[model samples]
Structure formats: C-alpha cells, structure tokens
Target: LWSSIIKSKNKTYYLGYFWDKETAAQVVRIKRLELHGEFANHG
Candidate 1:
C-alpha cells in the first residue's frame, strides 16, 4: 500500500492510502493544489 501526505502552513494532512504510487502522488497533488492554491508545487 501507498500513502500520501501534505504539510502546509504548519498543518499535516493525511490523504489516505492507495495500492499504486501514482494514485498516491495524484492525491497529494490535488490536495496541495486545493490547500496551497497558486503556491502549489506540482514537482
């Protein structure tokens, strides 16, 4: 299993777990965009 996490503005968000790495990364990316807005890092 793969898990994704995002830390923003001193907060840590748990984005759940997935069976694929890509899915995990995608979840983090979406969450980052939502949380960080224009400052989101897609790299």
Candidate 2:
C-alpha cells in the first residue's frame, strides 16, 4: 500500500492509502487544489 500525504501551513493532511501509486498521486493533487487553491503546484 502507498500513503498519500499533503502538508499545508502547520497542519498535515492525509489523503489515504492506495494500492496504486497513480491513485495516491492523484489524490494528493486533488487535495492540494482544494487546500492550496492558486498556490498549488501542478507539476
């Protein structure tokens, strides 16, 4: 399993665990957009 993690400011957000790396990465991207807005890095 792979863990998806995102850190913003002083808090850490856990996207979840996934069996596939692409899924994990996708989750991170989605969460980042939600949490960081225009500050999120797409790459």
Candidate 3:
C-alpha cells in the first residue's frame, strides 16, 4: 500500500494513500486550509 504526508510550516498532516500523487495531492490540499500559497505545485 501507498501512503502520503504533508509537512508544512504549520504542522504535519497525513493525507492517506492512493493510486496516484494527484489523488494524494488533492486530499492534502483539501485538508490544508491553514496555507494556500503552496501545495505540491498547485499554484
């Protein structure tokens, strides 16, 4: 199984796992409401 996590300036959050990075990124972005400036090149 695959797993992903986000270690932003605020804190570290678990974004679960998926078949692709895109899916993991999407979940990360959604959970990451503290910062919007950066998110896996989602600028």
lDDT of 2 by residue, 1-43 (tens): 9999988888999878999999999999999899879999977
Give every collision pair in model 3: none
Pick the winner on lDDT between candidates 1 and 2: 2
Number of the predicted model whose lDDT against the real structure is largest = 2
Candidate 1 lDDT at 17 equals 92
Model 3 bad stretches (over 4 Å): 8-10, 34-43
lDDT of 1 by residue, 1-43 (tens): 9999889879889989999999999999999889879998798
Model 1, residue 37: distance off in Å is 1.6
As for lDDT, the candidate ahead, 1 or 3, is 1
Question: Which stretches in model 1 have alpha-carbon errors above 4 Å?
Answer: none
Model 2 C-alpha RMSD to native:
1.0
| Model 3 lDDT tens row, 1-35 | 45668777677877687998777777777766546
Global lDDT for candidate 2?
Answer: 0.92
RMSD of each candidate?
0.9, 1.0, 3.7
- Global lDDT of each candidate: 0.91, 0.92, 0.68
What lDDT score is found at residue 32 in candidate 3? 62
In angstroms, give how far residue 15 of model 2 lies from its true place.
Answer: 1.3
